[model samples]
Structures are given as structure tokens and as C-alpha cells.
Target: MICIDSISFSFECSHTVLEQISCQIEPGHCLAILGNNGVGKSTLLKCIARIYRPQQGRITINGAELNSLSNRQLAQLLAYVPQHSNAPHMMVFDAVLLGRRPYIQWDSTSRDRQIVSALLEQFQLTSYSARYLNALSGGERQKVFLARAMAQQPQFLLLDEPTNNLDPRNQHEILRYLQELARQQQIGIAVVLHDLNLAIRYCDRFVLMKDAAIYRQGGPEIITPQTIKDVYGISAEIIEHQGARLIVPQMDHITKAADDAKTTANHH
Candidate 1:
């Protein structure tokens, strides 16, 4: 399990990007972090991955503090997939092999090769193992990166906007793979998602951030129209479709009406 307490961070004296954020992510569960642009969803993911140090908070994996872990130790515990994937011009197999660095010595071991081969097959990248990273399409590269992370064999996976560059089908494919990983391997996953529909469909729970803090968090049932309007400043309608909650954004007609009402009240 990963536990965060009173985590906060700010850059260059600006307002805090994350404010006293705390959450518990348990094994075998998938969490989706949802927010508008610039709401610090990615920043929160970085803190969990130990990429950015929180000025005031503690992050612990299992029972050990994250700050105490060495780079190699951390790499073995957590696998991070950022929004953008840029790999060297090497073959896909070599790229995925980088995930084994934490386990292998200076040279690749036979076990490492076996792990990579297995992951390539699992991600359906065996056919493209010899292709260079630059030659693959965006979705293919994303899968390669995921395979690289899976090769690390980390207990937890952190993804930031992982579906940003993929088509709809690939998006579903990647998320489905993540869900399968959580069930099959019992790994904990935290992913930042912009698509509310997909988050509702795939995520087990959600953490909604606004104004540099966690505004509300729960399952999809708690994501009401008022919640969306309050957090996102946009009107929306929520409905249930085959047991899943669907959020549909509406135009700002009520906003204009409210403004007109305020003007009339002031004139009177």
C-alpha cells in the first residue's frame, strides 16, 4: 500500500500546486486522478513516484518512507509512465530492457531476457521488437513504454496522462491492460485521466482535485452534476447508463441567467 500525508508543494513562490494532499492507494486497486488543466493532477502523480519532493508531507510505500529509498530501490518498487514517451533510437527490445536495470548487475542476465520476452508477448509487441523506437506509431511507442515499466516488475505503477497521444481503440486497449495487470498481478495503479467517461468506466475510485487541493473523492456514483459545476465551473448533467455514470457537459445558459439576475437585483 502507498500512503500520503499532508503533502504540499509550490514553485518559485507561486501558489501551492498541491496542498496538504493525502490518500491511501492499496494493492489490486486502480485510482484515477481527475481535474481540469493546471489543477496539478500530474504534480500529485510525480510526488507519489518520488520524482518531486513534497515540501511538507510524508510518502510511504508499505511501511517505509519514500525519501529513504535509494534510486535503484525506488525503481524496483514503483514504475512511472509519464504523459510523453521519448525513447532512444534503439530497438524496442533494448528499450524494454532498461526496466531490468534495477535488478541486473552491469550486464543483462538470462532471467532479464526472459522477462523482457514475456512482457513483449504480453503487450503484443513481439512482432515489433526489432523496430526502432522512432519508427513506431504513437500508440505502439506507448505500449513499448508500458512494457518497459512492466519489465521492472514493480508492485505499483504510476501513469500521468498515459492516453494523451493514443487513438480511442488504443486508449481502451491500454486501460484494459492496466486493469488486467491490477487483477492478475495485484499491483497498485494511480493514473491521471482527463477523460471523465473513461475514468468512470475503468477506475475503481477517483481523486478529484481543484484549487490545489482534493475537492472530493469517491466512486463514480459521487460524481454528480453539482460536483462537476462546483469543481469545473461548467454545467453538466449526470446519468446512469447500464450501471455506469455518464457525465455530459452543458452550455453555460444558467451562468448567463445568473449574471442577468444579479444585474436586475442590483438595479432594483
Candidate 2:
């Protein structure tokens, strides 16, 4: 498990991004970090990935302090996929094989090659294994990156907007895969997602962020209509369909405002 204890981070310019945030990423579950843009969702993930160290507080992964761990040691336990990745001219197989660096002493071994091959097949990118990353579409490249991260076989995985480039079908597929992977491998997974319904449907855990801090953290029950309205400032309804909770946001707010303006003009 990854325990974040009162971690707060800010830029050197005195602009605070995350404040006293605390959460946990438990094994065998997929935790969704949900919030509006600029509310420190990505920043929080970066904090966990060690890309940005919090100015205050501490983070411990599987009973080891994050600061005490070496870079290779940390990489063996946690893998992070960012919202965007640069498309290099490297072949897909070679790119994913790079993830096995933590385990390789001097040269790549057969086990590393096998892991890369299996990941390519698992993500349905075997045909594209020889293709360069820069030649693939955004969605394809995203899957390749995910496959590479999984090749690391880390105990914990952190992803920022993993579905950013995916279409609807691909979005569902990827999230489903992640959920199952967490269950089967007992690996902790924390994903920063903007799609509320997708988070509700695919994730078993939730962390709702507001004002650069965690507003609520719990099971699916914490994601209520009122909470949605409060955090997102949008009116929405939660409905149960076939034993699944769904969020239906009211899309007529703009039209209602326009009608109210017309009524005021007529009275004037």
C-alpha cells in the first residue's frame, strides 16, 4: 500500500498546488482520483511518482519511505504513466523492453524479452511491435506506453489521464483491463480521471479532490449527486441501471439561463 500523509506541494513562486492531502492506494483495487482541472490531481500523482517532492509531509510505499529509496529500487516497485508521452523513433518492442532496466544488470535477458513479447500480445500491439512509436496514432501510442509500464511488473502503478487519447470503446477496454489487472496481480493502481461516470463504473475506490485537497475518500457511495454538484459545480443525477451507478449531468443550464434573460428583457 502507498500511504500519503499530509503531503503538501507548491511551486517556488509561492503558488501552492496541493495542501495537506492524504490518501491510500491499496493493493487489489483501482483508485480513481477525480477532480476538475488545476485542482492538483496531476500534481498529486506527480508527488507519488517522485517527479515532484512535496515540501512537507512524507510518503511511504509498502513500508519504505519514498525519500530513502534509490531510483532503481523505486522503479522496481512503482511505474507511472503520464498524461502525455513523447513519440520517439524507437521500435515498440525496444521501447517496452526498456522498462526491464531495473532488473537487468548489464545486458537484457531472455526473461526480459519474454515479458516484452507477452505485453505486446496482451495489449494487442504484437503486429505493431516493429513499428516506431512516432508512426503510431495517439491511441495506439498510449496503449504502447501502458504496455511498457506493465512490463515493469511493479507492485504499484500510477497513471495520469490514461484514457486521454482513447475513443469511447477503447476507453472502456483500457479501464476494464486495468481493473482486472489490479485484481489478478494484487497490484495497487491509482488513476487520475476526469470522466466521472467512467470512474464510477470502473473503479472500486474514489478520492474526490476540491480546493487542492481531498474532499472525500471512500467507496463508490461517496460519489453522490450532491458531492458531484459541490465539487464540479454542475447539477447532476445519479441513477441505478442494471446494478451500476450512473451519473447524468443536466445539460440545460445554459438554455435555462438564456430563457431567464429573455423573460427579463420582455418585462423590461
Q: For residues 1-268, could you state the per-residue lDDT of candidate 2 as single tens digits?
A: 9999999999899778999999999999999999899999989999999999999999999999999999999999999999978987899999999999889999999999999999999889999999999999999999999998998889999999999999999999999999998999899999999999899999999999999899999999999988998899878889889998889988797478678889999999
Model 1 lDDT tens row, 1-268: 9998989998767889999999878789889998889999888988888878989989999999999999999999999998876678899999999999999887999999999999999888999999999999888898889899998999999998888878998899889888888878899999999888888888887888999999988777667788877777778888889986788877576678789899999999
* TM-score of each model, paired residue for residue: 0.90, 0.95
Candidate 1, lDDT over the whole model: 0.88
Model 2 deviation from native, Cα RMSD in Å: 2.7
Score residue 211 of candidate 1 by CA lDDT. Answer: 93
Full-model lDDT for every candidate: 0.88, 0.93
Superposed Cα deviation of residue 139, candidate 1 (Å):
1.7
